[model samples]
Target: HGSNIEGMLEAVELADGNPLHLAHINAYCRGTVLPEAEETELALKALAANPNISCESYLSPLNGTSAEIIDGLPGSMVTRRCLKTGGFTEDEAGMEAALLSGWAQVNYPQGQEMTLLTGEAARDYWRGQQTLVSVSFAVNPVGPRVRLATAKKADGSFAVDAVSTDGGGIPRNVLLAAGLALVDLGGLSLQELVAKISYQPARLLGLANKGSLTAGRDADITIVDRLQHSAFATIIGGQVCYMDGKVLGRGGRIITTAAGADYVRSQGLEPLVVDLADSSLLQKAQKR
Candidate 1:
């Protein structure tokens, strides 16, 4: 029988002389706690010392264990259709949903409560509001593997505090203030956490020139104030491109390149020209 760590321990006892395989052991507390790891090591050593029992543990990268949703997958067509009917422009619906879904899966834990409302509820809550939604899927072969959660204000406004977790197996780096110095400190200081842990993981991944206080690198840095989730300033490529949370630079520079313009124009064999007659159209055209 398939089981988590505790269940596996019981199975070991019940199997008597039979062989057993510990599958996806990391899903349980055994992988997280020091004592559990020690216990597992001891148990394996004991099993190896015995002549009758054979045991083995399989380990896989946590990311690799989770399910993957491929582009143009059959199941995704439902979401695609829903978004189109929901008044989302094709590109906006597809790209935005993909991006949000990815972010949600990475941060939230599995088995959390999620509600997908429709008709009046969806209209009352989500209409004309900027929001972020997140989901968590379990990597374990155990029961009830996927879960979702959402946070919103009383007036149907989406709250910034809406974050999800995959059980407690959230990445250590993403916790930022809560993981490094807070938790016991009543609450986490976002500013301090950003200054510390958030960038280190990227550096460790051989993005050497990406995250640093040094010069001549990418100059990609974010500055934030206390108690605010938004960054005060963001610099890239030795230029202060974003300040006061607003992006500057446009027209074939940081925001776009001349090559990008050529490609877009080439797509339809049309010369892209801006018409200032309509304010809305002018703004959209400028972005392109």
Candidate 2:
């Protein structure tokens, strides 16, 4: 995450103005490989200058990676990365031993039980698993997290476009409560809050009818308890899906990219076209 931001920015620059959506950039600036504060400043500067790039950050302190993806050997860059910040051993045997010794947590099946594997058990699991296996790591810190979340233009609008959970089924979803918490701390205003969680993300995705409450827009919405900092109710397409911790509905449709564009065009729905190379989020900073 540390110097990865530098490399990612370089790639964006090399893309010759192609649109790029960077994910969980706060994790990259937290200084796993480079100094945190320095990298954060550099990242902010790069983002301010690049209108083509938009990114999101999650509020959680933990970031995750797949154990199956690591090379799991001495002298491998991934192995070195794990060893440097994640307390992994230098070699494959060491990694196995570390896994057995509770050095790494394995994401198991069933309820996604996080079991600490060790010794032969860990080695065996690694050897046997054909599909992907994931591991959690605490690679983020508060300094970069806060800085990325609050980055702003001269006009005080947020520079980091959105706050995403980046969590689907892995249970790391913290966008709702965490965003509300940020509002309570004066880190962001309510309108800005809406921008970060709803408007901005919708804009990023080119979902013209999803982010706002205006007529003809989708009724997908969530009501949050200001006092509790939690979701009070959930609505989707003018239907009450959930309220008071009870799910009132279940069923959703998945739209593939090809199908999505086709449906929109067939319906004569001209959604807003987002500029991938120059997002509205960085307008002020880019102007300055």
Among these predictions, the greatest TM-score belongs to: 2
Consecutive 10-residue window with the lowest summed lDDT within model 2: 270-279
Clashes of each: 8, 6
**Candidate 1 wrong stretches, greater than 4 Å:** 1-134, 137-199, 247-288
State the number of backbone clashes in model 2. Answer: 6
Per-model TM-score versus the true fold: 0.30, 0.77
Residue-wise C-alpha lDDT for candidate 2, range 81-194, written one tens digit per residue: 655565655666655655666555555555433544445666577668842566545567778877788789666667688887665455456677777888888988888888
* Stretch of 10 with least lDDT, candidate 1: 142-151
Residue 214 lDDT in candidate 2: 95
Q: What local lDDT does model 2 show for residue 25? A: 78
Candidate 2 local lDDT, residue 148: 83
Candidate 1 Cα deviation (angstroms), residue 64: 14
Per-residue lDDT over 1-288 for candidate 1, one digit per residue giving the tens place of the 0 to 100 score: 233345555655775644333332334423322344454544443344332332212121122112123443313332333334334433433424533443213233235433333333332333233322222222222111110001123553211111222233434212322233242343334443333233432322224455456666566776654355345776766678778856774433211223455666656443323222222222323344
